[model samples]
Target: MGEEFLVNLKYSPDIPHSVDVIEAGGLTKYYGEFLAVDHISFRVKKGEIFGFLGPNGAGKTTTIRMLTGILKPSEGWVRIFGLDTGKDILRIKEDIGVVPEMANPYIDLTAMQNLFLVGRLYGMRKGEIRERGEELLHLFGIYDKKDKKVRSFSKGLRQRLSLAMALLPDPELLFLDEPTSGLDVMSARLIKRIIRDENKRGKTIFMSTHNMGDANELCNRIAIINHGKIIAIDTPEKIKSMSKGHTVIEVSFEPFKFKPGDFAYGEKIEIAGDKVRIHTRYPDDVIKEIVHYAEKNKLKIVSLTSRTPTLEEAFVHLVGDESE
Candidate 1:
């Protein structure tokens, strides 16, 4: 298996014990009169990529800001690596890596210089900063452009540089906010590769993203938040299973109309023109039943297909009410 596959695989040892690297207790944050986050509570285990997913203005960013100590909560509490963020805000900040949604590397400085400044801000010595900067730039495939001013860099290049700056400290927990946003396919793939590689080194990740594919690809578990609340939180399979038990099979035959009475397959019948859609847990049973019924009724069954629900479908099903 590839390294990406391995990083995403669930191992017995990967299960978390009492030692949660990130824990929030009824975390609520308010901006003026608006409750941006409402009594959210979850624990992110050490070395696990816990994904927070939602649409824009869904309080995902607010929760992240509170956890990272950038914004204090109006109520509740957050603890990072067993240290209370409110009490040890400065200490927690020093031990964490953060990649914000925006790539704001110093526009005037070269990529190397930008990284050097980041290392310095993290309190690394001159030589250490220089070495780490080079290593990170190289790892992110931006070493060749190290001397180029960030202003001259492409959107993808700047994103990679921002990620490198975040990784400079080798922190135990990394926060990535829309890490793959605004990047080309190749650049996004590179960033995803580094994320997996870092997780393999036992660094936990807290990712907030609108990209479901990225969350499904990288996260061991994901929390879907909306309207300042979490709607679902679980493994991808479980979350998807909550909405659908089995695939829906659709069959179409020659232009044949049917009276409501003609379709008698219990709970598995939706008639439209020449097609019938069947909803059932047993694909084989449905196929046999449909075939038998069609044969008995002297109707020709032209085609049949079964399709599993996609995560997008599950998300729509769960959040469709909120959308309305």
Candidate 2:
């Protein structure tokens, strides 16, 4: 594990047993008269991947800035590693890494140089910087381009380099804001894989993104925020279950001749050529009705499947309600 290769720091083992790795109480932020973040409270346990999910302008970045000591909260407090953010900003920064949204490395500097700069800023010795920088570059699949100036790199490569820089310190807590925001599939996949690998090594991660698929795959628990307020917070399964009572039935028929309205049991139905999606509270009732209709019309069922609401659906349901 990468943790084994990280520099050891003096940490007391006798810290309070109930201290969360990250905690916030009534955290709020404002810009003039406009509230950027409403009073919100949450805690991130040690070694857990906590996701902050919301649409753009949902105050996800604002909350992260305050927590990371880059911004002061208007009416609350945040503690990291049991140290108050306001009182121990420098001490807390040493143990944390942050990759802000669309962060860019020094364009004129080579990738290796960027890492070296970050390492020096953190007061790492020259030998330590070179060795660790090489490891991080290789891990992020950018070692081959380490000598190339960042200005010539593609967006995906730049993003990868940004992450590599963040990891240079081997931080215990990582704050990533939209890590995979705008990247090709391969690049996004690579970033997500690294996140999983890091989590396996017992690092706590706090990620903020609007990408539901990534949130579902990577997050242990997700908090949905909108309009500067958190609407829900729980495991993905529990959040999805909140949209219960509606089962989605996907069916394909050989004949492919069926109108959505023909299925009376469905609360909503969507038809696309040979495939039909039926949303209903009673899956059995809907399935029976479809089977009977198919049999009567001599339409053979090619395939059928049923699924509960997905996280995306739950998000839409929750955010949509809040918007109204």
Candidate 3:
């Protein structure tokens, strides 16, 4: 029999070993007496686009810096592709790419030259660098602007060039921080398409962004952090459902005022504006009660609908703050 047959090749392990492309255990970073990251732990699987979300000063950047080896953690561990980011800095860098919150391409060089320079720094030969540069320029939709000085490029173009530089090494992992920060709608959409295409090619992406919409659209899994602490981490659907189960429906009527205490409101009810939103396992029952009250008092119905939970709603619920 062949070696494959002799080894019980008909059967496979229940779980594959490629689950964790990035693993962190109690990862923490301290600057002086302040804790920037407070012992957060999470795992990202291969080919997964993991979204890291937090408001400004929420330690999102600090966590990314530590994972990319720009800074070391004060406590705990971070492993990328099973290699310690701290101990295997050089090896890890060889297979990872980072797009910082800011794109600072060399202003003195042309767009093409910037990419070529990056390729050389990656130890690629001249011919290889030229080939890769052309490929990347085309990939980023800047091939026509290759000869233009980076200083003259628009912010969107510059961002694309920076991403091209990061992709020069064909890394298995990519780290992007606020990549579409200053992009217009069209540019942002293009970048999103590029990210999607890269992920389709089996690249693992670790992304941090203030754009909740993009995070909801792109992430395979998401983690919400606040004040350096992780509040929730899971598939977007699961995270949203956690809030959905406690969702409230609000019905508003003109010339009728109702106090919450009048009814045995569920624990998840809130009073806002001219409406009283209440949460329950049975929205129909709540609606019936509201209709009964309105009819009893002969109230005029203004608006009546069940409020479904959005990712934004889930964020506000978990973060305990509403977005401006």
- Per lDDT, the best of the predicted structures is 2
Q: What is the lDDT ranking, best to worst?
A: 2, 3, 1
Question: Over the stretch 46-152, how does candidate 1's per-residue lDDT look in tens digits?
Answer: 77999998888999888888999988899999988677888887777776899987887999999988888888888899899889889898888888999999999
Candidate 1 global CA lDDT score: 0.81
Q: Residue 286: error of model 2 in Å?
A: 1.7
Q: lDDT (CA) for every model shown?
A: 0.81, 0.88, 0.83
Q: Candidate 2 has which clashing residue pairs, if any?
A: none
Clash count, one per candidate: 0, 0, 0
Lowest lDDT sum, 10 consecutive residues, model 2, at 1-10
Off by over 4 Å in 2: 1-19, 321-324
lDDT of 2: 0.88
Name the regions of candidate 1 deviating beyond 4 angstroms. 1-18, 244-246, 250-285, 293-307, 321-324
- Per TM-score, the best of the predicted structures is 2
Q: In model 3, how large is the Cα lDDT of residue 127?
A: 88
